[model samples]
Target: MVSGSGVFVFDSSGKDYIDAVSALFCATLGFHNERLIEAATRQMRELPVYPTALNRTVPVVHALADALSAAAPIPDAHVLFATTGSEAIETLIKTTWYINKQRNPKRHKIITRRGSYHGSTIFATRLGGIESIINSFDLTGDDILYAAQPRWPRDALAGETEEDYAHRLALELAELIDHTGAENIAAFLCEPVSIAGGMYPAPKGYFEAIRNVLSMRDIPLYFDEIVTGFGRTGKMWGSQTVNQT
Candidate 1:
């Protein structure tokens, strides 16, 4: 592709194609947006890049964090920024592990669904459900567990209702937790919508049932909203849309 406008991209041969997937699912603002371009130009001129460390950060970084905290769905949200989506997800994984260890030293495992893509980092890639990516890595960790993705249509019974399917899936999670020992488990990480499995949202009441199961052992649920964030699921976050919040 040579140039783009709105959601359309033009190739070298002058063929136009719709950037329906938002350019690998992150470029939602489209291409050559005047406002974005202007902001970029201005920021580059003012402060191109700064390493936020040793208790020091640029004003724009702090401003963005404040804005995101106010805009986030989670109550009293705190923001942590990363250079890329993969790095962001990796940060989340590390943060959860750190907190979990502080809470309980044995609580080190993280449960995620099958057919979900978390990130490309070694640890994040292990948490992801894609077999191809996981296999590509020579490094392996046993703390991550895989549960079935909550796509009711693909895994539901012939006559099962959404509620029933959700409950069943939650039951499976509970069983997995029991087998693994709840005391040894950390948080359950999830993609609000499946990325590896074609962007399917969880079934109705899926989060509710999962929450019920997690509540028994005080397990926290964390959503990786890289895909279904920014009103992609008709809400600011997919967690709100799927009742995960």
Candidate 2:
């Protein structure tokens, strides 16, 4: 209701439905904001076919980069634009493997959670921890290790506290790392909150504990902020809300 645009209808039927998911939850700004519509119109009118690989530049791209940089925690966090979240994830996963290969070829595996969802691409689907995704494609990616998901509501024992549950999850992750031999793992990737895995928020101290383990093992933590970015979790970033450093 922030911008308040009425839902679209294709026929004369008066029945209308709420867009509960908001176009795969990407339309956080809601439908048809004047600014967004105007921006798209302007971009389409201007030079728009420049590909980044061709080293071509566009004013809108530069402007977006500047704005993102101004709001980013890292002043120089380079932004790689993609048409969708899946493409962005694909870029990151491949980039991670390439960079690790350059530094240490043995460190090729990426660790993720058992119930997480990255994207629908073959590699990303394999990287994700959802059983249905893996089972549907007969994916047996040995490089990625699936750690136990930190589901406080479901995984926590009857008498267990949130802090205790987080610690247990951390311990289990540490054990997995030890079993997998951290030297062979390039990075551990996850969203700050489990979104596609049912929107379950992480238990308290989960990120800090996991971060410490990754730090000790020299594994880079990739916070997939595609869903939780732009203050969706009542903060600028979910990592900041969870105190992940």
Candidate 3:
């Protein structure tokens, strides 16, 4: 597409199509938004560029961080900003890696659901659950594990209730953990609603069951809220929608 307006983008041939993907799901706000344009103009006129380095940050950075932390569901929340979703996810992965290194070096593996996506950065790409992307790019990693996605009807049993299916998945996860040795696992990462592979919301009690399994082994759970943050799911965070902690 050459350009976009509202939810539609125009091609070179003058044909307009609805931008259903939202530019890799990053630009939540539609194009040609006057408020966003004005905000960008105002910020640029004052301070064109600034980087948040060691003990140094611009006023806008602090203000935006404060606003994000204030709205976050995490208690005593702090904000970490990145230029792209990929960078943010990469940051999170590194943080977990660092934590595991300090706590237990053996616990370095991260388990993610099949078809789920964290980002496209080196480690983030390895964390993704899309098989095609992984195989095509040769992005396989020994420390990353893939589990089945909670795709509802497609994977559900003939008469399995949503809760039952979720429990079954949890059991499967527990088995995987046991086989791999829970002591060697670092974290469990996933998107609350799968986006990269396809949009699919987990069945109710999904996180609850997953938590039950993870808690028994004291595994940390993390979610990639790239597309579901800032009121995207009618809430400030997708964790709220999924009742995940």
1-245 per-residue lDDT for model 2 (tens digits): 33335343223455455766665657777677788889888878886578766777677788888888877766588888998777898899888878877889889888888878888888888878989879988988588898888888788989999988988888999999999888888899999888877777888878888888989999989888888888777788877777773
Q: Which residue pairs come into collision in candidate 3?
A: 115-129
Per-residue alpha-carbon lDDT of candidate 3 for residues 182-215, written as tens digits (9 for 90 to 100) = 9999889888888875677888888999989999
- The superposed Cα distance between candidate 2 and the true structure at residue 117, in angstroms, equals 1.0
lDDT of 1: 0.85
Order of the predicted models by TM-score, top scorer first: 1, 3, 2
Which candidate ranks first by TM-score, i.e. highest?
1
> Which one wins on lDDT?
3
> For residue 116, what is the lDDT in candidate 1?
84
Indicate the residue-level lDDT of 223 in model 2. Answer: 85
Off by over 4 Å in 3: 8-18
User: What value does the lDDT take at residue 133 in candidate 3?
Assistant: 81
Residue pairs clashing, model 2? none
Candidate 1 wrongly placed segments (more than 4 Å): none
